[model samples]
Each structure stands twice: as structure tokens, then as C-alpha cells.
Target chain A: MKTITSTVMLASLFAVSANTSAATLDEVVGKGHVQCGVSQGLPGFSNFDDKGNWSGVDVDICRAIAAAIFNDSEAVKYTPLSSKERFTALQSGEIDVLSRNTTWTATRDTALGLNFAGVNYYDGQGFMVRKDLGVNSALELDGAAICTQTGTTTELNVADYFRSNDMAYTVVAYEKSDEVVAAYDSGRCDVYTTDQSGLYAQRIKLKDVSAHKVLPEVISKEPLGPVVRQGDDQWFNLVKWSLYCMINAEEMGITSQNIKSKMNGKDPAVKRLLGEEGAFGENLGVSPTWCGNIVAQVGNYGESFARHLSVDPLNISRGVNELWSKGGIQYAPPIR
Target chain B: MAKEESAGPPEVTTKPWNDPKVRSIFFQVVLLILVVLAGMYIFGNTADNLERQGIATGFSFFGTTAGFGIITHLIEYNEASSYGRAFAVGLLNTLLVAFCGIIAATILGVVIGISRLSKNWMVSRMAMVYIETFRNIPLLLQIFFWYFAVLRALPQPKNSVNFLDSIFINSRGIYMPSAIYEDGFSLVLWALGIAVVAVVVMTRWAHKRQDQTGQQFHTIYYSIALLIGLPLLAFTVTGFPLSWEIPALKGFNFAGGTVIIPEFVALWLSLSIYTASFIAEIVRAGIQAVSHGQTEAAHALGIKAGPTLQLVILPQALRVIIPPLSSQFLNLTKNSSLATAIAYPELVSVFTGTVLNQTGQAVEIISVTMAVYLSISLGISAMMNWYNAKMALVER
Candidate 1:
């Protein structure tokens, strides 16, 4: 009688644990696609094409997740959300993952119940002004009316920048990025401010790109990346490791075309990651070809960045985005 | 015979509790239970999820240092300030814009409403045009136009336009003379208060006399005299204490004077212009609602058009106007939330967006913001309702 009761108790414990983990993975697999929330229109990061297909550096992250799940990078439904609506949409389960250029801060991670997968871009706040203003440095912007977007860290940075310099400024704020850009172009504001990358993208669309210049001053640190809901550990791991695979793949000198040749490479880390040596895929509840599928399907992080942002007409250099071994900040953990 | 007739109803005798009223009560009870259960279930799920994720669920963050930045504020603030203080600043900024917008809109709305019925064709038509043009466009677009297109286009600080030797305008903002208090300033203030009280008493006396004797009195002229004469007399006795400190163009910007930033100006201008259109319509409708016979009757009694409006038309028109006008006031208060879109540090932008992001207390911040708006809306409507009741006509 005692043995029978103990067996039943053990069975119930396993049953409970099994039920909890089953729900998250089952839901994603059943849906057959991952829902990704992206920025409205930040060029080279996340923007819609003429065919209404979303494409950018951030969009690639979502595609990598899709490849890991459905083995098809195209199985992603993209939803464009504003900064204000992005987190709420995630919390409400409106989107499975958010790959907008969202900054990972301590408060957001702990307080908002979110898990940032990994940093995709290292950015900082910067200012832009017309060349005619003759403002060589940010300090010369004293008493200037600055056009900035609301609901961003840029707003607070404006106050701090002015106060620290013992200067005053009138802030003209708008809600949308387009409006801020338009205001700056119309001569309504003496200066426009945002992330350095955003300023570069916005400047290209200006009527005369050469007329305006982004200032040399970088005001604040903005480490932007993908984020997911906090409760789903399985989903978080899938996302976190998918990003890790990309970074690791680049560090291993594994490109999309070379992934097949490197499958039998002598490197233990590459073997384990590519499912040639270990059962890492089993632990993630995915097929053995998960990492290989992501590389073959979506390419590595460096490849995506080069194809979309760098070495293109935009020609954004990979200053901080390069692999750590190559003197950049991107360092991935060992897959083993 | 009555008992026998009553016994006929015994075939289907029913108790009060079995009636439709009782059934409705029981149904409502069930619905209430179901709703509570559903709410508790969702709340429980959320709490469990939060626990599993190791996210704290509480309002303790309100006391924590915001550590996030705010761009514009009416009060002193820093990243080290508590979230509570930040919320206070946001609430205050919202009230500041709403109060200014209401007063300015009311003044413009009244003038335009009166002018629309003017004998001069140009005046009425111009007023009509103003109302039509502003009323048709969205307030958000107007705010964007003012903040981005109009204010941004101003000259740089170096080339700011100087007006009246004391005021300056640039992309930065407007600078003008600030009041400077010296010795004996209180005497000037006391004199002004006394002048106002004197005018009020004289106006009351004039009204009483006119009601009793039916005689004409230049009450306006007498009231103006009492209001200005007493203040001037006191100023002469105590020596004028007030002084002005005009703003001067300094190295980079204006110095030694008050500065009104462009954000505040854009928000105030857009809100007033947008709200004035609605108020004008309310005023026109109120005026039109007064029967034509009332105006004709007043004129037949030898009353001029001005008095006919004041003594006969307005009192009745106010009865129709106060309710809708109150709604417009509430709407203006709510519409001020858009101030966030322009970084005016209004309630929604400051508390909901900035503080929430800084503190990571979304649920608490959003709840507080909603409560602030709800209270302001309720307070305005309550005051309006009281005034409406007082102004309503009494009919036999």
C-alpha cells in the first residue's frame, strides 16, 4: 500500500511539471509562426518594403526565431508598434516577441516583467542640426529650440544636457518620428535630437541630406535588443539562444554558405552547437538541426547586418557591432 | 363574495419572491458572482505569473528614486527624485495647461459668439470664418503645426526678433518683463483688493435701486469709478510699490525676465483655439434657443437691443448654455492629455510614459493618471451641474 501511494505521488508531481512546460512550446508550434512586434519605420533596422514585407536588422532576429521553430525563416507575422505601445502589447500577449530597437534597462527588465534576449545594437543619443546654424558643438545650442520625440529617453537627456551646461533651451516635442523630422526640416526647430543611428537614417530621407549634420556628441548609452514576456521560460530560452547562436556562429567564422562544410570541423564548440556532438537541441525541445537551420536559413548576425545596414548604399560601419575577437563589443558565451 | 373571488386566484397563487422583480434580483446576484469570480481568476493568474517570473507586484516603486529623466517641468526635479514627486509635477503641469486653456477659450468664445451676431457684416463674417476654420481641423494636427512647423521655424537665438525693447521671440521661446517686488508691495495689493470690494458693493447697490424705483443709473460708470478711484487713492497714500524688470538680451538668450518655453505656448495656443470653436457653438445655440418673442417683447417695452440681450435674453440663454458649456470644459481638460505628444510634461506624458518607464511601475502609474483625469472631469461636471440648477428657469 505504501509503495503504491508513493508511486502515485511521484506521478502527480511529474504530471504537474509536464503540464506547465507543455503549454508554451505547444502554443508556438500550433500557431506555426512567431508574432513579432517591430518599430513603425526605422530604416535599416525595421521598415516595410514596397511589397509591405518587413525587413531590417531587427526583423532578422525575428526570422531567426521563426527558423528555429518552424524551420522556415518566412514564418513570422510582423506587427508594427510605437514605443509607448510596444511593452503593453507584449504583456497582453498581442505579440510573442518584440524586436523593436528597445533599450534594455534595469527597470524595464525587473519592473515591467520582460526578458531582453540579447543586445543587438549599441547606440547612444545624439543631436542633429542644420549646417547654417553654425553650431560646432552641443554647448553652442544654448537657448535653442530642440525638436525631439516624446515617450523616449531623449527627452530627459535634453534637460540634463542643458542644465549641466548652465544653459537654457526650449523643447518642442512631437509624438511620431516623422513629425520630429518634418519639424526639423521646416526650420521650426533649431535642432533635432534622437539616437545617432536614427539621426543617420532620418538625415538620408531629408530633402537635402548634405545640408544637415549630426553632432559629434553622444549623450546617453542605449543598448537596444529584442525582448519577450517574462513568464515563458521556454520561449525566453529559445529566443535568447537563437541570438546566441548567431553571435557564436560569427565568432566561429561560420557563414551561411560555409555552415555545411564546418559541420564536421574539429572545434568542439562548433560541433556541440551544430548538433554534431551533443544533445543541446534536446534540452531546448527542438530538432538537432535547430542552430544549423537558423544559420542556413537566416544567416549569422554579421551577415544580416551587412546585407541590410552595412556595405550597402547606407554603408553604416559596424563600429560596435563587430565580433569581440575583431575588437567589437559583441562577445557570445560558449555554447558548451 | 370577495373571499370567493379571491379564492379564484388561489389556482395560481404566487409569492412576491417569485415575481419578475425577484428573478431580476437573483439574476443580478448570479451575474455579480460570475464577474467577481472572473476578475479574481485573472488577477490570480497575473499574480502567479508575476511570482513565477520573480517580478515584484506592488506600489513600493513610488518611493524609489525615479532615476529616469524628465525633459520639461514646472517644478525642480532630478533623476534622484521619488516617483511620487514626478507624478505631482506631471499633475501640476496638466492643471496649468487646462486652467489656462479654459480661461483663454472662454474669453475668445464669448467675444466671437457675440460678434457673430454683430450689425457689422465684416465682424460677423470674420468671426464665422474663424470658427469654421478652427473647428474643422483636429487638435493634434494643430498642436503639431504649432510646435513643429511654426515654432521650430523661428529665428535662432542670435537672430531673435526684438519686440518693444523688453520682449524677444526666437525658436527657443518668448521672453518678457517679469514682475519685481520692492518695499510696500503689499500696500498696492491691499489697495487693489479694496478697490475690487468697493466696486462689488456699489454694483449691488445700483441693482437694488434700479429694481425698486425702475430708474436709470449709470451703474457701469459708477462701478468703474469705485474700482479705479480707490486703488489710485491708496497708491498715492502709500507710494506705488510695484516695479517691472524688463528682460534683456544677454550673451546667449534673455536674462532677468520670465521665459515661456515654446512647448507651453504651442499646447496653450492649440487647446484654446480648438476649444473655442466648440464654446462658440455652445454660445450661439444658447442665444438662438431663446424665443424670438422674448426679444420682441423686450423691445416693445422700450428696452434697447443691448438691454434686451442682457436683461431678457442672456438669463434664459444661460439656462441652455451652462450644461453643454460645462461638457466643453471637461473636454478641454481631457484634451490636455495631448500635451504629452508634444513633450509639454502633461499628466499622460510625464507619469504614464516617463515615470512608468523610469520606475517600471506601469499598473500603478496608469491607475494614478486615470484617477487624476476622472476626478478633474467629475469635479468640473459637478460644479457645472450646481450652476446649471441655479440658473434653470422656474416655471409655474
Candidate 2:
């Protein structure tokens, strides 16, 4: 009986897949909205307001993509997904693009049959302990109980760190970041470990924010970026180059307010990038003013970074995220 | 009847193979075939799409090195380990939580369930309040509350709350004494094994003698005697083998003992409390299902209230209760999947979420997880059904 039911289910799934294969791109374009996957809630990364308006660093990328395609930033729908559901949603075409704080790994890129457009943030796993514990360094946490989120790369890093250091520590694993923070705060865990950026975000939420300090040791590299499903080359190019345009704009000193003036500038590379010459957008099946539309609608990479995640109020520095010319890792290919 | 039979035989109207019933079956078979064909066609297209994109399909990745990390696990794991081993660790962690939660829930649930029906008003009200409070709220919220609001408020390890000079509680986790084994531990284990075997044999002998001689033997007392006697003899023969490793404060945190993380405590406590409410309802219904007259009848037969309940009411009530009770148990098992929300490293969190993403084997990993859950549910149901059949009233 179970087999029979499963067979029926399999049949239904096939019918849906066949129906979807005809023209997925047309369907997305015709609908006038790109369904972009995002994180549930990560304050400055991807969070929704009480009015249901979505805004974040990742949110701006989705908006930028939409602007490049439809010439309107609002022509996008956000699908907030947990870490577990994000891939499946992308695989099933529930979302046109995934702009969540997803890490770019070989297994995810090749094994999951997905393509990462480009790296947006170069992050690493780190530990956060209460200041009163007097543990100034990750090495000082030899026998400490660590609160960690399960189903993440952070989990394995914790185990590896402890084992390599020849220190025995108990692990209090949770599924969500919030719970990991809660457990750590409740005196259930000696330390809370995750991405350094996440540690900064969560530390502020502690009852006594002054009491906790994020340790200096970075255990592993986590290059987080946007992604799209494999097999759609045109759509992939459109998203990939959109991010490149932002980075290039930042490098070439292009801002939203000065993009029009910069279009008539002397530099041939800048002219080609600002769509003053050549037809690069036509190759990606977009209008000639696609890059112009993206910059105008969502601002350049620096603007987006400052507006959402700068060191002003959120206090997030552009340490590794700064442009390559500025001693950072964000280098983009030439528009020409 | 003769006229009808003659007419039908003449026309061969009752052709069993061509009858409407048979045709209906045939139609269903054809429909099933069409459906299966359509399904296969879609699956083939997807495979082709994946192939064109150079994406390898199948479970072969399970044998590959994970090259990934995990936060907490009972067994040893490394980035160099096979995905299969990582999966095993995930399964073990899930089973560990489920096993612990089941025992805790059962004990707490039975106590609360009985209390709801107690004569003491405050006790019943308290149980009622507990049921209403925990059952209505979502499990995820409770986990967050426990982890963030409750556990995160703990004192630092240096100022950990000490109790009885053996246990320590702080933001890190609860530290408790673990039993250490000495040279005599082997003798103590053997003695315990012998005691268990002796008790079983004595109970069988007592039952047989009672049947043969029409004389009742206090089997419980005899069994208890054998169980204790063998163990005591062994302990006397060999010096006590077990020692205690009382947890003590080291440089900062408690060292040399077992630690129970607050995440585990929160998950376990929340699950037990939430599930106990439903279990209480089942217990109440099971008790109510039994006829009240059976108690009176048992009383007439010289059975006391406790014995009457044990002998007459419970056996029958259990028949109705077992089916639903099994479902509740299955519910608890499935609900444990929510442990992922709190980073419990259950099957869903480890295998499906992390491993699948790390390996990019969504289809294979999800299928494996679904199969594991299906088998667990089926296994529990099968066990319950067997017990039900054995205890069913036999009527001639």
C-alpha cells in the first residue's frame, strides 16, 4: 500500500517537472517578479520590518538583480528560508535566485547542482565568550562547553578545533542561532561559536552586552554569496555580472548620484561600464542601460554596504569587504 | 429464480471475467500504468537536465570524505571521515535524544496524568495548568525561551552555582559525578547478570508449582530474594568495584566528570512537558474506556481496589489505548525533528540540512532521512500491534 502511494506521488512530481521545463525563464519574466530566497532574519543581512518590507545587504542584491532585468527594483518577491530549506527551494525553482548569506563551498556548488554567482562576504568561524570568564582567546577555551548551531559548517569547526588542541569540551548544539545565543546566555554553555559577523550581531542582543567578547581566533574560511540553480546559463550570467558591476562601480569611484555625469567621462573603461559605449547588456538579454538601472535603483556596492551594514550604527567594518584597490578582497573584472 | 437462471445461462450474462467489477479493476490497473509512465517520463527529463549540466546523481557521495565540520557529536568525527560515518553520528545523536526524552516523558507524563485525576484539588489544578501551558505554545519558541531567556542568564564558570560539593551549574552546562570502575567492577557486573537470570528462573518455577499443587507461591518475594541474594554474595566475595568521580572545580570550570549541556536540558524538558499533556489525555481516556461494573465485579470476587484495577480494568483499557498511544509515541519521535531548530543535531539537522548542503546530495540525503523516519514509525507500530494481539480477549 505504501509503495502504491509512493508511486502515485512520484507520478505527480513528474507531471509538475515536465510542465515546468517548457519555458521557466519566460514564466519568471512574464510574472513580472523574481522570487529571491533570503535568510529568515539576520538583522543587517536579511530581515523584514513590521510592515513586511524586506531590507538588508542581501536584500539589495536581489533588488539590484530585479532592477537589471525588469528596470524596476520592486519587481521582486522575497522568500525567507531557513538554512535547511534554502537549497531545496532553489532546486525546486521555488525561488528564481538565492541571495541568502549562503557559504560558497565545493560540495554545494558541484554536488548540490547549484552555481554561486560571486562571493560577497569573506567570513570565518569564531567564538564568543563572556568577558567575566576572563578567556581572552579561543585557545583559553580548552575545557569549555560550547553552544553551537547544528546543521552548519560551524559545528564541524568546533569539533576540529577542540580535537586538534587536545582539549576535551562538551558541546551544546542547537538548530538555530537564536537558541545557541540563548543557551550561552542562560549559563548552559561556556562559549557560543559561529561566524564572526553572526557573533557580533548576536552579542548585542545579550542582556549585558558589555559582558561578552568575541575571541580573535578564526577557525575556518566561510565565503558567503548569492547562488542560482544550474542549467540556466543566461539567468546565471545576468545575476553574476550584476554583482560584478556593483564591485566595478565601487572601484571606479561611481556613485548613484554621479553615474549620469560619469557616463560622459573620459575613461574608455568607465564609458563602456556605464553603457556610454558597447552593448554588453544585450549579451545577457537585458537592456543597454541594465548596469545604469542597477546603480540608480540600488546604489553601488559601497553605498549598499554603508546603507545596510557599515560601521556607523551596526558598526560592521569593511575590513575584508573593501575594494581590492583599498587593500580589501573585492576585486571585479573589467567591464570592457 | 429458475426463469432468471435460464435467461442468464442462455445469454451468458454472468461472465465473471467481463463483469463490471472485473472491468473496474482493469481500468484501475490501466490508470496506474499511465500514471507510472508519466512519472518515469518526468524523472527521465530531470535526469537528462541534470546530466546536461554535468551534475552527478546518486548516493555514491556517501562514501566520499565530508571535508566538512560538525559542532557536537558523541562519536569521533573529522573532516577526513566518510559521509556515511557522519550520518551514523547524526543518527546516534538523534536516537540519544529520543531515547532520553521517551524515558523522561513517560515518568513525568504518568505522574502528571494521574495527578489530573487525583482527589487533591491543588495537585489536579497544577497538572491542568501544566497541560494547558506547555501544550498550546509552539515547541520552537519554548526551546528558544529555555536557551536564550533562561540558560543564557547563568553565572560565569568562575562563579558557577555549586551544590552538595559534587555538582556544578553555570552558563557552560551542568557538571555531575560519573561512576568510575575499579578492578572489582567486573565481578559486580557478573553478579548483577547472575541475579537477573536467577530471578527469571525462580519466577518460572513458582508459576509451575502453583499450577500443579493448587498452592499460591509469593513469586514476587522469591524473585526479589534471588535478585538481591546473588548480587550481595558477589559483592561480599569481591570488594566493591565501583568508585565515584565527584565533579570538582578546576582552574575555571568543573573537570573530570560528565556534563549535560543546557541545550539538551531545554530540548528534553520542553519535549517532555509538551508531550506529557497529550499522554495524560490518552491515560485518562484509557482509564475511562474500561466499564465501571468490571471493578464492582472484581470487588465481589474479593479483589481489592488496587488489585481490581490491575487485574480487571487495566488489561481491557489498554486495548483501546495502545493504538492511539502508539501514534503519540510516533508523534514524539517525529517532533524530535524540531530539535534541529535548537541545534540538537538530530537526523533532520545533521543529514538533511548540513550534510546535504555540504555534499550537495539533496535527493539522496532527503530520501535516506525519510526512510529512517518511516522505518522507525513502522517498527514502533509493528511492536504495539503484536502486544495488542497478545493481550486481546479470546472468546470461544
lDDT of each: 0.79, 0.77
Query: True contacts preserved, each candidate?
Result: 0.34, 0.48
Q: Poorest 10 consecutive residues of model 2 chain A by lDDT?
A: A1-10
Interface RMSD of every predicted model, in angstroms: 13.0, 5.4
DockQ of every predicted complex: 0.24, 0.42
* lDDT of each residue in B14-69, candidate 1, tens digit only: 56676666778899999999999988965566556545555566888778876444
Candidate with maximal DockQ: 2
**How does candidate 1 fare on TM-score?**
0.87
Q: Please, what are the lDDT tens digits per residue for candidate 2 over residues A1-336?
A: 123223333443344364235444566788899899998777778888899899888898899888988989999899987675676677666788899888887767886668999987888999998787788888888767777765577777787887788776766666556656766776766788888877887777788988888888999999888998787788888889999998898888888989878877799888778777899988878888888888888899999888888753368899999998989999888888
Q: Pick by TM-score: which candidate is best?
A: 2
- Docking class for model 2 is acceptable
